[model samples]
Target: MIKDMQDLRKLAYNRQLVSNNRLVLPEQVSALESYRVLEKPIYELIIDDLKTTSWTVDELSRRYGIAKEDIREPLLIAMRDPVLVAEGFVPRRVGRAQRNGKGSNVQYTLLPIPIEARIFDITLGLSLLHFDTLLVQHVDQLQFIPHDEGLDAFREIVAEYWSIRGDKVDQFISKQDVNCVLSALGPLFIPNDGGIYDRIRNKLFEEEKLLVPRFTRKKINKDIKKIRRKFSEGFFDLTDVHSTVIALSDLTRFCKYSNRMSEHAELLKISEDFFYSLFIQVHETVPVPASDADALTNDISEVSIGAGQSGTRDKEGTTAMSWEAPKCPVDGTIAEFYTVITSETAKITEKQNALRCLRKHLHAPGVFDLAICSLTTSANTNIQKEAIKLLAQLGDERAVEPLINVYGRVGATLSVEVIHALGSIGSHEAVPFLLEVLDQKRFENRIAAIKALGQIRDPRAVPVLIRCLLEPKGEIQRCATIALGDIGDTVAGPALIKLLHNPRSVIRVEAIRALVKLKYTEAIPVLQQLLGGDRSKAVRDEAVRSLKSLSMV
Candidate 1:
């Protein structure tokens, strides 16, 4: 039997571990024996009072003979933090701390938190359902305080909360589950809850609005389930999983997919480009043996001994003949070692595939680095081609040097692919590299280089083309003159004016067109000389057309 009230109270406090309420084992019981003291009576009184009816801080403190300040902050914090209150706790505020009109003297009333804070609160709990109600209550209440700091704070909180729930929705997907996530995504679009934030969300989700359940869910459950099943069924493996996850991340904000899509996409992009690169670097820096020779020798010897003469018997008591089982060499264990190698390879592959999908979807920076690395490392030319194609699609300036570096390092076919990739990038950075390639003795690389420089359209390329134009080689000079026209820079105007007098009619025609592209009014007098002053009708006609194109009509 319990001796005193304090002892009975101690037993009750120990029994009421609110957070993790599972049956406690003897070890836990022993562990709790030394547990530090907490304000048990005060905590219990508050819980009991909350269960019966909502009570103001003053009323509760008066009822329990405890100070109001002693429980005010703790009660409020407990109600807000899920780890503390879980499902049952509710919080209410007392009469206005200030005296106002008649009804202002009302007792306890539930105080709704700001919608943004509510979104943030729900995010921490991993609950999306509360977002809509919180949004409906707080949308109009949100003040557009026109300060950058205030706006930033508002955007950051909303984005962060949206991002958290978005990720949860993406991690688990079913039509019903997605609908739930989408339904919970209501706060993202509600106006004045942060107008700028709503604009951003709406911009991303506008196209997806036509899909089923509209904005009712966080993500498209169908796509997620399909991708996840493919991953689990071995149809995807890690690479496929990485790619699908990356793709989802990239399209997350825009797709009818889960809210976390953006966060995941952003993460996958970083992992693929930065983390994967670092991982590969780590692997490279740490060497692994290519083969275990000693082990191989032992296995080979064992195999030879075991595989005694095919038809030869063992000795004495044995029958006429018996075949010994062959033993595999230790070196042959490379096949078995493949499992380990494949696992490592799979991890790297998954990281890269995910990055590639993210690069495609998000168009994030450093995507070119991943694509180029993929190209450089791939043994298969087709895979290299694919990487080059992706870099071209990205059309970023960062890709120019890497593509050129690959062209310089690889085989003829891969070199051509890289050159084409540069041409497709269409950035100013590729011009110098392309020009340098034009000076090379090889016809194939030179031709591709010339074609690429012509497509780039940077004025800086004009000097290089003019140098090529002066060369005695007919094809190179001809291509250079034509490229100068495509460059369409006024700087090329004077250079072309000097070229019109050249004996080559092709060069003369190209110069006229180049002048037209540059819109050089200074060349009109020089063109009239070519139009009729003893020049061929082809040159004359080309000059007239050039003049017309320049609006010198």
Candidate 2:
């Protein structure tokens, strides 16, 4: 009776209403083939079952004696196939009541195939299913795959998936499933695919209340302990090591952002242990070979000769001891020290001693480079913090870019260290980025940015710091006062003077000290007034100190 696509769709819809599962006619099968429905035997079986009644994957698996995993792919394919969708095979989730104390299951039912603009949705859904399946199948072996290609493909799929599903992606792919995929992909080292993780995080944030509560602290702690045990036992897959670390990092970050860090103290400690173990396993440096050392010595001798230094050659054709080339800054002892610092078998005391030696020679030729590399590559927080401190002390503009990069990639605690380093380096290049950090809503980040900005003493930050002085938070205003003083800018003088009249003695005391640093002679009268009339002894003492400093100037 079908004359056209409309007639076929109508027939298909009408057929679903009847109880009897009549045989499909040859003409009907041929008509369905035009829509590409029966391309595979699984497709045929799925379609035949749908013709009788909507079924869950579990039901289809049981009826055909197939594994649930085997049934899921074909079911997803049918739901997303363009031709099948156009022929009206729309998938809808139907909830079944709980049975035998088991939770309800989501079942897929088909709608009359639409002949409209569902093609894009169909393509996007299929693409998601395809990549999801691929990643799941090759999760452990992803290190062998081309990271850029896989990352690009997955990113594109996520973009399209987000465009269609928006915040409701959780409905299509559960939060647990998303977490599983992220755990697999987030820790990758070579591809550096944080963009994919960021996108998923943004989508999840749209329904954060619904999703975040499900990630229980107990469950996360259990997962971390299991991964850590495998990692320490040397049974963990090499490919999975980074994955485990990154997954823990993500969980730690999640708890921090959700204000649940207090509830996950054990999880954080375990995560730090995992990071330290990963660092010890992977960050070992090979010493220069003997041949390379000889070559380096020869190169140094040649450079000395070029610079008009006399280099005598012995009978063995080596440089004579009477006129030797200058020694390398990183000598054998320093090199050995570096080796011990990164050694997996080294005792804690041995490692600490090696670290001290390296710190003492931090100004040596290779030490700065080593610290920079460690800052970027080491997941251990203490090492990373030490590197940040050393790089800041070096005050080299070269460290600016690397410090900024680390700020973006690390967690809140490490980010503060990076900001401090940037400020201590005092490079104008960090100004723009530091200004951006000042705009963030995170209280800790904002405070760190303020302090860093002051240390850099960039006048460009004066206006922003002035605005922060007006905020209601006493901690913010206090920090801003110290920064303005460190910056020693006269423009903040009026704001600083106004704070002298505030009720909080701490605010008045900070303002008095800031005025003195600014050398604002005009504040000398206000300082004199405070010295005589301030109620708090601390404020009066600061005022007296400010007056004496101003009078000297």
TM-scores vs. true structure, each candidate? 0.33, 0.41
Task: Report backbone clashes per prediction.
Answer: 17, 4
User: What 10-residue stretch in candidate 2 is worst by lDDT?
Assistant: 180-189
What TM-score does candidate 2 get on C-alpha atoms? Answer: 0.41
Give the runs in model 2 whose Cα sits over 4 Å from its true position.
1-330, 341-353
Q: Quick one: best lDDT, which candidate?
A: 2
- How many backbone clashes are present in model 2? 4
lDDT of each residue in 1-553, candidate 1, tens digit only? 4454444343433432221323222234434433222244355556656655556666655564545666575456544333222232223333233334343222332233233323323321111112333434533432222222122223333444334354333232221211111111111122233443343333222233222232233444555455444332221112232234333433443342445555446433432332222112222222112222221111111111122223223342211222222232233322232232223354433332343343434344434444555555545343455567678788877666556544533444346667777887888767666666665554555666677787887877778777776777555666777777787777777777888887766677777877777778898888876654423445867988877776653
Clash count (model 1, backbone only): 17
lDDT of candidate model 1 versus the reference: 0.46
Question: Relative to the unseen true structure, what is the C-alpha lDDT of residue 410 in candidate 1, on a scale of 0 to 100?
Answer: 44
Please give the lDDT score at residue 156 for candidate 2.
Answer: 36
Give the best candidate by TM-score: 2
Runs off by more than 4 Å, candidate 1: 1-370, 501-505, 533-538, 551-553
Instruction: State residue 523's C-alpha deviation in candidate 2, in Å.
Output: 1.9
